[model samples]
Target: MAGILVVNERYFPDDELEPAQVGATSFSRSALRCLWNAGLSAGVILYKRAEELTEPQIDLTHRSGFRCATLRFNFDMGADTVSRAIAEAAARLCAAYGFSSRAMLYYQTDALLVFHPQELACCVTHHGPFVHDFVETFSARETAQAFGDAAKALHLFKHQELGVNSVRSNGRMFVLQHSQLQREYLISRGVDERRIRAIRPPIAPPTVSEPLRDERLRSFVEGAELLVFTAVARLDYFKNVELLVSGCVQARKQGVPLRILVVGDSAEDDVARQALRAHVPEELSAEFMAVGKLTKSQLYALFSLARSNGIFVCPSRYETLGITPLEAALSGVCTLMTDSEKVEARRFFPDAHRFLPSGDGLADAIGLAYASPSGVEQLGKELREAIATEISEENFERDTLSAWSYFSQSARQLDS
Candidate 1:
């Protein structure tokens, strides 16, 4: 029996663990479940800040400043006893298991994955001639390099030279990209085309047999005459929740009766929330509801009500592939998303559904969506049909099985 060790920095839900039980699990859990269902003997390993190394774990791997900086960011320590303890624990585990320990996987939540490519590569290389696979759900340019470096290191360790197998690429995006650009990027990076798999992150399928629209939410949507913009993302720089609020305010000033709903927690930390409170006219503020995080059921119910009433807007500064828009599309709601040049929202939605350039442009797009409710309705119907055709259980099974086959082949190669 081969043991597959999955090193993740966060907790996963049970459904995302084994047996592949879908429907409402955390992101990490869903990924784990996906891996387990593929028939690999996998177990989870959580890496805490207290368990990181003080000095470099692998020789000539990471620079001293880089190592310290990584530790500081990940563990909140400049130099401490806890850091040493964590380092020892990781070293022991690596030494005991050796490079033959099935497959070593790493998944992280913070920006560390983006910054420390060389260190990660060194760690994997030090561990050895074992098969190494790197998986990241969210990563920026810096962290992506770390992932690339780890792949590169694995190739060098196994082949004894750096040529083609030195690195493998798997870039996760919220929106699918044109196949040509994706392929070109992979090839340019010297990644094995076979090794680079574009696995779109999965959302826990909604399970309510019937929609759960409460009277308050329904009434709220129904009463809103012009436009209703909504966003459900953490209060982070990239989310650009403020853009929606500001756009709504601008739309109202322009004589548009636009109402906005900014959902999810972290609103308290949002400077924009404060700015909106100060800038939005009292009448307009009433129209804009900043209801914090709601339960999944509550969110779905609200979505259903919104579909029956208004348009959904996702004004993210950067979304690898925005899922909310897809959810809105499925719920029979029209969406107006930002047109980040790199993103491929058009692949998923009609051109009319996207607005590029600025927040003012988003306001303009909202008006467009509102101007032709009948056309929006037609778009909604089309969206639902597309989702139904593309995201069925059969489709999930086919894609998932294909992914498993690829992983299985890699695992066998490692065993050999």
Candidate 2:
């Protein structure tokens, strides 16, 4: 069996473990597990660093302005400590592993992969240029050079795979286009397109065969008289929680007594909870409950409840492929997501307009969902049947095996 090394930068202390960290770690672990289950042998290398940067490895990789910004964000003048110790440590680990000679790097984010060209054979990434091309985050020169190096490295480097999980399109481009564009842009900068592959993100089946529910959740679902607008996401800009809250308020204004359950923690330290409290009208805010991070059992319970009730909504600004909707579909829950014409969600559902659209159309969609709760049930039935046909352990195994076959062949070619 061929061996693969997976490198990740996000390692949390038991006490410091938060939802974002948990989510990132879970994604990384799941991807690794998928690789392993596909029959490829793999190991994980975690980074622990004390300093963010010991030396500037490549000055040409970043523009002067971008370098200053990176320094500002990553270095503490008062403490003289680098905030990016994790990324720096990841670089060291990659170098130590002689990644260029043997292993491929499956990166959680672009930041960790940027500074370590010499240590990697190829990189598999989720997000595209948004993170790497940030003016506030890195210098243009740095961004330019990183792309340039990544492209050059591609010829000798091995492969670069882009894993996109969601399918949505907006503002004249589909979400998948971002990955395609990134690949194209890298190719324009001299990376070989043949080395690039786009893989749809996979969802892991539920761990438990049976669903578990707590008394609070049981009571909440049992007593619900009106529609339940449900959304679960790590509170982040991409999630667009405020839009959901606002949409809920609008739904209530239109005489829909909708109760929304928001799972996951807000980044702004209870800012979402507070905003719902003060900004949302009394009835709407009263109907809103922001339950922070939940255990897997609790989440499954929510899924079960939503499945039974037929009301799930994801109003993300951008989604590569929203996994929650698939989970909801598997649970027999009807879901409404933002209309991104390019995403697989609509393709998966087909009855796309039933879900809300981004911006102004959300409130109307929520109101519509309230008016026709049974519509969600019917949709759920359709989804359940469709998912039963499409997503099975057998198919997952097949696809995973195919991915492994490709990986192994690539490994052999590199070895040759």
lDDT of 2 by residue, 1-416 (tens): 32333333333222222343434444454555565565443344443333565532211121111110112122222222232332343344434434433434444543333333332243444442343223334455544443455454342222222222111111111111214435544555444444455544455446453454457655666566544555454566556677777776766677766677776664346765565456567645556667665554556667766665546777765454566666666667666667754234455665543455543577776666556646666767776677666655555556544554564465456556
Candidate 1 weakest ten by summed lDDT = 122-131
lDDT of each: 0.47, 0.49
Kindly list the per-residue Cα lDDT of model 1 for residues 1-416, writing each as its tens digit.
22223233232322222211111123334444454565432344344344454443322112211111122224343334433533443344344434333333333222122222221221111111111222232344522343345565454334422212334432211111112334444366464555544444354436562454456655666787754656554544445677777777777777776677766545345554565557567876678666555545566666666665577777765444555666667667777777764343345666777787476887787766666757556666666676655544344445544654555466455446
Off by over 4 Å in 2: 1-23, 52-103, 114-120, 127-129, 132-191, 205-214, 266-268, 341-347, 353-360, 373-375, 387-397
Candidates in order, TM-scores: namely 0.63, 0.67
**Model number with the top TM-score:** 2
What's the TM for model 1?
0.63
